[model samples]
Target chain A: MISSFQKLTIAFTVLAVFTGANSLHAQQFRPAPNAHYPNHALMPPGHVGSQMLLRGGPIPGYFQPTQVRCPQGGKIAVANEGKFVAGQPSTLNVGLLIGSPYRFKITEIPGLPGTELFPTVELLDRLHPPAGLETRFPIPIHLTAQELRMAAEGMFITRVIYLEDPTNPVVVQDDANRQRFFDVRFNEDPLRVADQLGRPMAILRMGSKQPRMDRQTGRFMFSSPPVRTIMPVKQSNVPEDQLQRAIISTPSIGRLR
Target chain B: MSKTMKTSSRSYLVLSVFLASMMGCITPGTTSSGPLEKQSFENIPRPNQPASLTVSDANSKPIHRASPAAHQQRLPAGVATQQGPATLPPQAYTGPNAGIPYPAPWTPPGILGPFPEDEYVYQGGDAYQLTNVAQDFSIDNLDEEDTIAHYHTLDGKIEIERTNRIPIYAPRFASIRRIDGLNQYRHQDHVYAVDSPLALDGTAQNIGQEQVKQHVSTQRNIGTRASSLYRENQKLRDMAHQVASTEDSQMLKPQVGDLLNTKVNIKNSQEAQLSIQQQTALAQSDEETVKEYAYDLLPYKILANNRIQTNYHYEIADGNSRLDIKKVASKQDALPGELLEFTITFKNTGDKAIGNVTIVDHLSRRLAYVEDSQNCTVESEFFVNPTGKDSAILRWEIIEPMNVGQSAQVTFKCRVR
Candidate 1:
């Protein structure tokens, strides 16, 4: 008779087999903190059957699978300390700006947000400079099913480049270029993104900046995580009927900044 | 099974948890840490959420590596890889070398190389450089067993989902060109010969109808005797003279004279008529067709018998990598150069690939030529590689490639503008 411990061990073994460190979603969409995106984006479904489908997630139904929200408004004021003062006004409430009058709660999200901070990363997500071959970090990040949906609907975070790379220009055409960026998605379970509860992150590579393990081989030497922040923007005015489906957002994201 | 002392049991458990967490061996909330440069999230909190993460021990022994290289065995735990001597430049360390299973940082398949040297890659921002795509850190000690189990939980054991196939739509077009000098010549001197029965000039000179009929009737009866002949001659001469003096007679070649200041329009009308070949060509232009319908399945689907569900998970511009099956819906907005997304569902009408799958598609020669074929069963074209997800568009230009007997589909972006 197998004991519970044995069963658990077997289950653990099975789990390891299913996880690949080099998933595009894991790296691009914050699959795991350490997982890198090896497959780029169009990876064959890791498993078969609809069981792999995740419908519900833990976020308050607002932060979707691969999306996050930082809503502003409603009004807030603090008195002398970090406490809300009832029936009294304070300086915090003055001159406040509300970006949008209304915001929709999404059950689907792409990812919460990525940071360039530390203590959460065990690796980076990047590629070599074209010498030959290089390794990237195992970015263990995965958006929940809800996040994936929101991303598909344009309700998630996207990358906007500021400084331009003459060598690599940015084109909005879907088929043009997304290989260098990390995309948020939920092909894998969010909870099991990295090892267990590992935070998601991204590494940026650009210019001649992509470090190489061996410059001769064009392998990745080092890379910086793509910097990002989430803010509110006005919703589009186009009606839903006229807009084509899947023209909304990308489930794949974030190769560079 | 407990080899260590009781006191070390907790340490062992902690070690186990740590290992599981690091490798993402298994768990519902197995998340990963970002690279050395950045943190993923900063103090994230929801109105109501699990206040704390699952507790595990951190005092466990450090897992050391005998050798990062030459292990041909398994990767070492907790040790930086040994790919180079000296410091691995700032942010270097993409992952393991080619031929080895992907160890972290290095997430790309086959080999690490620069982005395809093209405008698409160079102009895509710094993010598009092939070197820029690699992650910043490297992960190690990955066992094949781990991947298998994780996949099992997701039920991904060679069980392929409905793939978002890239349709090879190489549409061809006939060039509509213009000739430079045809319309410049405008002919203004050509004369038109305007003739009508009313314009006949011999009417006044002709004999009365009764006399003419009488002469004709008697001539037939007498069989043209000398007396009748003389009368016929006189009448014929009068008609001839009337014609010769009329305006139309001057227009005729025989009567016109060099000294006549005015000329009949007939002489120039013949030269001004349009060429027969040119008229025939214009008439045929009415029947030319400019468009054609495309076939649904250009090649074969992985399965048969089942109605294949379609998706737009794959992308074309990025060398066909990022795949998102569940979220995409049919629409023109998916991307540029894309057409329509078709979904086909098929079951094992035949045997499954079981492990590796290769779908062959012979390109329709009409639209686009084969650039190249890699892992593609057949067919290739220029500027595009026909492989797992590298099928291209501008193809349907001639016809859609759809195979009968199997269900297959793809969400494609059609070009309108």
Candidate 2:
């Protein structure tokens, strides 16, 4: 019986060898066609592999926008460059900012269409009424190149106020500063500016409403917001580049007003 | 003793099978695997034909209305989709950079196009010659709304109207000059077949004189004013039409005034000229009407010197698919302070093996120079880009040729910051 089994195995092995030899011969004997022009991989796994693997820049805080009384609202990644031609499924990641640790769910607004409705946005910690965390779904917009036009396409400013000073924990001074912030001016173009390759470019605020300008080009938004610019402020202590736009929410404004 | 030996032999056999399966039949060399069956597309619609001047004559597509007549849209709330503004936690996170978000990274998707609230707004490229000011068919507006009237011009030539602005036509038809050189030796019968643009039909649609003047002023005036885009585009249409029909066909006046300063209807309505003595509108169209076209290259042939010359006419059809850049060989990842790098791959999927072919590889100013590929005989690594995205072409002019089932790769780098 063992001898018979061995003979059967030998036969199968011979068959496999013959098949391999045949395929090899065909590959060698037959001439491959000439390579054509403009042959590209359709977003191969290797190509754009880094972007997919990282999912880094697509959204700020990586879809986890935590709202802290510490600073202004966090930024989210929410744009699409390239010509944004029709029918392509482009992605935009919006981060949610919840001030404190909390659990909440998103509820669609009563009247808005699903496509038009931005993911409901609010402090999950607060879960306030109507426009609260319950109603504010994360902003998941699916805009065609055409629908994008209807979006506000300019620069504007949004501010995040911290509760007084973190270290001193003083509500008094924060309120006063908050009162002055209301006086600041800003422009509001909603279209996010992307670098040519579609990377997000920083949006700035010109101290005054008018754009800060050298002779030819204009200044970024958020250049100023009633800060003590001349008051012994050092450059290093500042968190970000001067070109970046930023506004912090202060709790002191109530007493100041 | 014999029984024990048999049991041991069985164990040995199982072990050998396990080892064989681990390695499989793979060979050491990375030789080409899989079948040689490359899918050949038969008779793909050739996209070279510029939109017919008749496209201008075609009925204007209607604009998209977001709201129904029953419920018109009111002013939309100024809710900002500021991507960087909010950084959410990574609960169900599953990406490479799926960690905590910080100063926040700049993502391509998060980058918004033109916005009204932005302190700065910019538009470039040119409009399609046939579909001028086409809001509906714009590659930019293909998704949400679909009303468009504007067309795009082929690449290579830059036309600055009194407005001094370009519409950023699509990527396909952008051309530097009209004629793509033909195979003079092949001896084709039709003169127009060899010509990229048989006749440069100048159809200047009449935007009112006021709009023209605003363009003559500053682009700011045109951009801010209502209907300014419409007016400027109309003027351009009329200008193209006038060029197409005004000149005497028999003569190349080569002079400015040789073009008749007359109106050609957008609908191609026929009109006659009055007799020099009589106000009679003369019915005329033919060789008698001078038709000066953009330059055309007669049947000509030269060894593809391994250089890609590109004319960004920017009028590709909406149907064109995004290139598979992965097939391109040369590339760069981290750029030097101001430098950028790119690698593009292309293959000959068509039945005809391409030789002496000139390709348009779009490259912009932002990318700086590094290494280029062997496919291109000549390279332009120093091209500066005022805009972020540009395309570069690798013309198969010289060097080892390609076959029907083969591919070529190229790489380039540039400085963009």
Candidate 3:
């Protein structure tokens, strides 16, 4: 009886080990960070990259007006040469140049009351919207509650904003309230992956780091680039959830506004 | 060994094999192992040549529109597909031959007659005669009209009008100089070939010697005339130089009539005549005090007081693709003291080789070229002309010819004013 039990145990252990190996092999390959990856940390805060891009003079569709949406509702203010302004409540519609980095503050969180978070948004590229309707197809930046909470806990989070490729889209049954986003492993670069999937519009970095007291330090932290204030998008009569879905899905169709 | 020990040993062996297999899956290919900036070519089209011209920054993000209509739906937002404002359309190239076919089928062996291989033969006589031969003295080919018609101008003054005529009347002595030398030679050759004896007599040989002497004498006269013309031109050039180099105080002042009496447009069209007259009148009035000053100014301007350096880059197309180039700035706008980098991408997108590829960029007045900032994919010779106060010309010469489908990149930095 003892011998038979031992044989049974060995067979079960072998099968389990073989299954685990196969599962590991089936996993997708993730690229390792290159030597230049360290420079990402060396970059100073604010839109220094964007400010430099201005040197070549104005290019068409460069300072594309993008909308920053705090889905949970908060005071959105932008920094002017490191001075945070008295922000508008909930959403801020501002014109940001492509290849520019922008920093803005989010305060008076709806659920996390009295809480403020400073996030840097880098517009690595731009979109070609319809002629007169540039503001209509603004790049929607959704700052979710979960992301904010994690960031508040002193965790660094990076979200790559990308225009979903119509040809090959991630099929998810997401409504207006919930935008579908997936998390990659800590080692994998979300920016590279987003670029492979579609055109990466902006790179958003959210962290608990606050501005320093020194003037020069503050300048690097919160750069004041030229900003064109655009009118807020009109609130639609349709339900919030349905409206969000339509806006996101409409751009992926034949005629992109 | 005990049963439990044996089972544990078997499990360990299976686990080791599994671990080795799993290790292979975790580590990916080299493609993914790099920084985002190096590989971030969001604006550059795959395989290149999506548009003839594409301007992208150091990070490879395109800043200009390429082709609006065709690339509207295809390209990313700010980086439209089309030529940038700085890019001009390629100039039209119609070659010297134009509509005429190269090496026309009827082109004979270049005037070099039969038995060309026999170098010892006196071939210079015929060949030299072909070049030096006096053009046919015909009335039809005269540059000036033969008949001078006297007509009354609107002012009632008698005006001379040179008009073309049928030349039925006696020709001008100057117009009827000599017979066409080439025709005379051809006629003589035809007679000699048909009438020459198998062996020449002494009389015949003597006649040939006399003919040779006459030919030599004619050549000497032509050389003397050419020498005289050269000396006259030299004297004129020396006088012009002296006039130009003379001090303002030493220059002679001209009377008002000397300025007004200058005649222009002695040849060519009426429009040309009118333009030249206007220019001459303006110059004469501007420098009424000095005739030589006005005379030297036009040629001095034509010669260009400013130095102009010319360099060439040869390119050949295989009847398919062409050499395309683009310039992109790292930053469209920059602060006065900030450094900006520009990238120039050149590619030979053809089946044939392109020789001595060169790219020339003119930097704005506000930009100052940074020293030792240039980087190129292939070995190249770089030159910069700093004489321009408004702008600087940057030139990159690729020494080695680019083969089919070959591409190269050149980058340099500049500081904004």
Among all candidates shown, the one with the greatest lDDT: 3
Scored against the true structure, residue B334 in model 1 reaches a CA lDDT of 19
lDDT of 2 by residue, A119-203 (tens): 1112211111111122122211111221111222322222211111111112111110011122121221111111111211111
State the C-alpha lDDT per candidate.
0.24, 0.25, 0.49
lDDT of 3 by residue, B80-196 (tens): 344532222111112211111111112134543221111111100112111111123111211111112122222322322221111111000000001113344466567557444
Docking class of 3: incorrect
Interface RMSD of each: 29.5, 26.5, 42.7
| TM-score of each model, paired residue for residue | 0.15, 0.20, 0.30
Q: Using TM-score as the measure, which candidate wins?
A: 3
* RMSD, candidate 2, Å: 39.1
Q: Tell me candidate 1's TM-score on chain B.
A: 0.14
Tens digit per residue, CA lDDT, model 2, B180-240: 1124213433543634332221111122333547767786765676687779999999999
Candidate 2 chain B, run of 10 with poorest lDDT: B169-178
Instruction: Encode model 3's per-residue lDDT on A12-68: one tens digit a residue.
Output: 899768655544433322222333432231144334345445545333235666777
All-Cα superposition RMSD per candidate: 39.1, 39.1, 42.3
lDDT of 3: 0.49
What TM-score, to 2 decimals, does candidate 2 have? Answer: 0.20
Q: Distance from true position, residue A253, model 3, in Å?
A: 20
